[model samples]
Target chain A: MLVFHTALMRPPVIDNLQYAKFSPRIFEEMRAGGVDAVHVTVAYHESFREMVLNLEQWNRWFEDHPDLIFRGTCAEDVLRAQQSGRTAIFFGFQNPSPIEDDIGLVEICHQLGVRFMQLTYNNQSLLATGCYEAEDTGLTRMGREVVAEMNRVGMVVDMSHSAERSTLEAIEHSTRPIAITHANPAWWHEALRNKSDTVLRALTEAGGMLGFSIYPHHLRGGSACTLDAFCAMIGEAAQRYGARHLGLGSDLCQDQPDSVVEWMRVGRWTKRIDYGEGSAAAPGFPPMPTWFAGNRDFGVIRQGLLAQGLSEAEVDGLMGGNWHRFYAESFGPA
Target chain B: MLVFHTALMRPPVIDNLQYAKFSPRIFEEMRAGGVDAVHVTVAYHESFREMVLNLEQWNRWFEDHPDLIFRGTCAEDVLRAQQSGRTAIFFGFQNPSPIEDDIGLVEICHQLGVRFMQLTYNNQSLLATGCYEAEDTGLTRMGREVVAEMNRVGMVVDMSHSAERSTLEAIEHSTRPIAITHANPAWWHEALRNKSDTVLRALTEAGGMLGFSIYPHHLRGGSACTLDAFCAMIGEAAQRYGARHLGLGSDLCQDQPDSVVEWMRVGRWTKRIDYGEGSAAAPGFPPMPTWFAGNRDFGVIRQGLLAQGLSEAEVDGLMGGNWHRFYAESFGPA
Candidate 1:
């Protein structure tokens, strides 16, 4: 199928982060949306072995559907995937649990083609404090060694679900630029996972990229967020941090059951329920904003960004060019 | 490093099987030997998780030593490596211990880039009878299903350590040509692991390949075997089974200590020692024949095969071309 781009010439549309209940329908939706690449979450709280089982499942998908998607290992694959009209699926971990306590697994995961790894998920981890924790102690001693190892091996250190202090510490300590792949600016939405203005400034100053989140919980108006409003937030971020440092992450958790959310929230960390971001009244994946229900909505997001007064080049960068450049820099030996 | 070959043009000198204690020096030796590819043993008696750890170690090797070696997943990688002057490392298992009881892991291991798996190492497994078993009941119930699964995923069923009944059953039952990747003809060595004329006839008739082993235990005169005598044995077997079915495995356990051999022999199967092909007096890996101590000796073996009256074309195929073709057919979805 020839994918037509709304912008005459095609720009690689890369979602810097997503954790959907992926299927054929999702893959087709990616094609329909002209999504050139996706940084997919393959692990959250699973051990190294369980994460490998997840990799096996993805491998099956790669084998079963070669026409639609292929494993993405480097930044050049995005352009290759763009030219070939297929999505390049890059693996990532949403938490450090996949590496367990061993630092050697940092290189192992990278060799297995994992390009992104979050330092923490939603609680105090061995490496750093998660956003859900009350106190943020920042990067642990092992965390320093791990960051250096990740830098040496080309695995990007993601601070998406981590605490503010840890995120700042990582940004300051990392020899190379780090990423907050999916998080809104705290100035736009005061969610716990949202980045502070200080972090956004530090991240952009260090040449880091920030992908705007579309998970309803990260939105100011939640499920009721308008495309104009969301695009407007990105437009605002672009003004603060250069447009080259902004892109769509859209933490889309499409078609997931409430139990998955429970796993993400609890994950054997507590016996008592700790509803993270969600409340007892509504402890499930919140509905995505009406403007962005699925991957097929990226074209409209581009249109919305253009309507928000950003130039075509700037909007193209926001769509995927920036992440493509970041991916090229982030996923290889330093 | 422009690798020149003895055949005037390189024919991708491939060791169809080997299990060296690998390092940069060994990889350099393979390049020196004009070896294009190797089917390397990554597991003997490890569970699925442990095998993954082994994968992690190899992954590290691929990362640390890109100039000398690369991970090979397809037959074309052999040609690619030949041109690039590096050895393509194809993964295999000498035992089905890596898959455990999960049939799904057959495809999982294949997806993880494992191209071959032996049903049994040296004992009765859930899948088939080992050579040392008292009763050779052939393929188990799970064995049939696993064989079909392996056939579907393109993982070759290696029967180098399997009993005659099981080996025969596997050859008859499998749709694709199976391999005894590192065993000698019993007519020459009379070792327990060597193939009989009946089994060799069945295997060759079905287009299967038999890799001549160079382990001292598998050689006719042990470590003292002359290259002329060994090549003459292969030349004789060439008349019996055709040169297309013959290649080298060179079960070279170079630079390894006795403990590694003990691990290979025991591997948590029994509290008591299982000497395997060795006695209490010589309870370790035997010395390799001086003619084939490491990968650097492959060129001389080629010369020896040529001197022993194999046509250059036949010697080329016996070296790696035939195995390369076999790899093309054996490592993709059927």
Candidate 2:
């Protein structure tokens, strides 16, 4: 049977206070986690140019570390990466800022090996509204046009951070299946990051894929989430929307410091990164549980899945099979 | 019963020479023709700016000679012009050159009271393919976007000068009904200015209106066309797509000179104007037919319709009822 790990994050804490510093030990932990592939985002930076530069740097790093890093543009690449015993790193854009106002830039980025593109991150852009926006107006005039263009160009629109109205409009406008690459079920958690059950059902009915994120804040147990509990959450989603439609997306932020965490909390770059005592803790869930233990790694989570009742097949499907299938259906011939 | 002529062109030639020179005789003939409203184009010879200036000049001219000309932007305007015993002159553009690349300019022209705007004018533009273009690639990316925008903003998209592909694409993209506004039947005479029967059927199916033109070049007989011949052509189209879908677009060039005719034929402007020939011709029809002795004006055409076995209801539908309905559906209260 094909064995793949679905959600594996290199760093466990992204919006933490100590985001400025890099940790080489985190990379080693990811390698030991046996994660076949991972979706890495390089978009939500200061500007489009900066995002390009950061992606170029990531590309070079992947090139240097042949054993640890491999770029995956599609499902085939992920499969090949697993066969070759290398971690497939799929490039993603958390927001449409990199595209700016040009609709043609979508094709350009697809050519540049950025596989998954989200219309909006955590704010409104030219394309669509983000989840954080209070007014969830449907797609703008330009936004509808952009959706058609994206469909024509064969790009998978990720609605992980999109506003409700904009998300529904995208779901309606898209001819191909859309993906919520990393989100929780609002039915269970009631978090803004979680999707309502109605929206979730509609998404699956429209031939879309859902990625249940293992973020403690969105789960019933916040930082105290264990591998078994996370698996149970995913299993519930699988039962709700067939196992074929479900996948894992561990929104792990490992190396980031308290400053980065604070920056994310304020929701803008100019604002100070907040890492206060109680503020850092997620509601319901304990303070961000380090991956599985004190270590911010995927190996612990992999072992934790084994500790649960998940068979190897179910674990593999949860790990990456569903994501692989989704990628293949979305981006043809790649 | 309400009666109006569907098409009336101030003959293109008198005694086999281009009617480049304007004569007072033509104005007298128009008065005799009982023409209540004429779709007059100003973009053919001048740039967009020049077209605006020319229309302003004409507006002032109409103000000075209240008995001769009346500005008509709507069905009510036409009705008022007729009730007031003046010839209602509806301003139109044969080509979209005046607005150039700025889409916002469309709204400006709308504000300035341009009632009809064609996508192309016998040549390719930023928005669409013209009939004369070697390849009719349909609406360009911007063109498709513009069509949707036009529909949303409520601009009548005239396709008289547009290529077949561009016309079809516009029809599909526009949620509101489109108007050919001026063209003969390619089936009657396979002229580029004429539309194919398939396109006509599609237009009618979409609740769009077709405004047949009286340009003799598009007719089989060319300069030999008489008032009876024009009615016969209209009768054939009425048979093909019932009387309700048909309307009159006189394409009447009552005052343009021979130099303007030659400039239009060459598809370029001389030192007298800054634009091309395509813009000079009225949208949806061939160059204006030269004046002739036996040819009657708009009023005579109305009488001719009576002689063509059309009942009062059918004649009214063909003359102006259809246009009134189209304008109401397209512009709403405006």
TM of each candidate vs. truth: 0.90, 0.45
Location of the lowest summed lDDT over 10 successive residues in candidate 1 chain B = B1-10
Q: Pick the candidate with the highest DockQ.
A: 1
Flag regions of model 1 displaced more than 4 Å. A1-9, A63-70, A76-86, B1-9, B23-36, B61-67, B75-86, B152-154, B332-334
Candidate 2 structure quality by residue, lDDT tens digits, B59-116: 5456457676666666666556555655566666777777767565564455446666
Query: Interface RMSD of the predictions, in order shown?
Result: 3.1, 19.6
Displacement of the residue B251 alpha carbon in candidate 2, Å: 48
Give me the candidate number with maximum TM-score: 1
Q: How well does candidate 2 score on lDDT at residue A165?
A: 83
Please give the TM-score for the first chain of candidate 1. Answer: 0.97
The A-chain TM-scores of all the candidates are 0.97, 0.82
lDDT of 1 by residue, B1-334 (tens): 2233445557888887887788888889888888889889999999987887888788878878999899999988887897788999999999999888878778768867999999999899999999999999999999999999899989999999999999999999999999999999998989889999999999989999999889999988898999999999999999999999878787778888888888888999899998899999999888888888788888889899999989989998999888988888889889
lDDT (10s digit) by residue, model 1, range A119-193: 999788889999988899999999988998999989999999999999999999899999999999999989998
DockQ, structure candidate 1? 0.33
Candidate 1: CAPRI quality band? acceptable
lDDT of 2 by residue, A1-334 (tens): 3333445422111110111122346444555656666777766643554565665566556646867666667666665665566666776777777777766556555645676778887677788888877888878888887677667556788888888888888999888888888888887777777898877887888888887676566676677766677766676777788766767666665555544554444445446444321243531223456554322355555466556666666655555666776776777521
